[model samples]
Target: MTAAAIGASFRPNELEVRPDGSGNLLGSLCRSCGAHFFPIREACAGCLSEDLKTVRFATEGTLYTYTIVRQSTPAFEVPYALGYVDLPEGVRIMGQITGVEFSDISIGMPMVLVLEPFGTSEAGDALTGYRFRPADVTSD
Candidate 1:
């Protein structure tokens, strides 16, 4: 696919897929309180300040917690791994866990963000999204 097509984000406000095929999760950084929030909040929850800036979050993080999802809406597959990843910015992001099995995931494991094809848009174009994988794992 062309870079323009591949860079189409599943959730444009949350993920940014660059032309070089690299990407970062986007969030809001509170300049007033030095706090960070995922999903790009308009205000700081800590200080209730509107002085927030859009920032790209670090790809590396620690797996804080997780669960095996055996049930979900038709849009999602069953028995997928889900987890909270604590980034260096002190924000915890919930995402699907990949590159590791459900039985192998553990608390405090090093994780890294990975961009992939999520699903097709209404126009049948590919949409990019993110998943967290063990940092030690490499794509085959």
Candidate 2:
């Protein structure tokens, strides 16, 4: 696979699109306390550790809580599932849900992060981004 095959990351700092079409959500890990923070925190919230390192989070997680948003802002459409997933690294992340029927989504289900084209840049270039789907689901 090549970088051209998968497109570029929507937000390079938050989402990293690997050449193989798979990607990981980017976060910061506290070197001192092992605490992980999403969106790359400047300091560890749990232990107040300033020595943080960038890390790619595990793609798999467990759905902790969710909401089916029937309405949203212009950038997002309605009838989307928004959820909080608990990663094994001890971080809770919020992302859009995909690849499952609205009624089929449930708390505690196994989830896996996926990368897809999110939108276009000002130059009209494709921007790859991350979302979550049921672990058992197949992609088209």
Candidate 3:
């Protein structure tokens, strides 16, 4: 598979975190409707316009909804929290919640995106994925 296809399969529409370790998340914005999208798209779904612009998301958002997955799945690790986060720019994104236990997640909690290794790409190469963590958690 091509690199683009592998990236698309691994991250879908979310920004590509560079392998060199810059740790930047690239997102897509709709120039026609002001709608933001993760993983940058060539076309704007909101306005059906082809003029989509690429930008970096703030990485911070409010927790919208979440669930604890007790069952194991090939797509993700077990005992992980999966949820949608509402970005300040009015975009909602789906990602896994990390750095906290399932018992601590609450609706409307503040979250920030963090780059972490998720799984391998479709081409059997190491792939990095984004996960949400409580904003209050410090690097220390």
Best candidate per lDDT, number? 1
Question: Model 2 residue 48 lDDT?
Answer: 87
Q: For candidate 1, what is the lDDT?
A: 0.92
Clashing pairs in 2: none
lDDT of the candidates, in the order given: 0.92, 0.90, 0.76
Better of 1 and 2 by lDDT: 1
Candidates 1 and 2 compared by TM-score, better number: 1
Instruction: Name the TM-score of candidate 2.
Output: 0.92
Which parts of model 3 are misplaced by more than 4 Å?
1-13, 19-22, 122-125
Q: 126 in model 3: Cα distance from truth in Å?
A: 3.0
Order of candidates by lDDT, top first? Answer: 1, 2, 3
lDDT of 1 by residue, 4-108 (tens): 657488998999889877999999999998999988998999999999999999999999999999999999989899999999999999999999978899999
| Model 3, C-alpha of 5: deviation from truth (Å) | 23
For candidate 3, report its TM-score. 0.77
lDDT of each residue in 106-127, candidate 3, tens digit only: 9999998877656786677766
Candidate 3 whole-model C-alpha lDDT, 0 to 1:
0.76
Best-first order by TM-score: 1, 2, 3
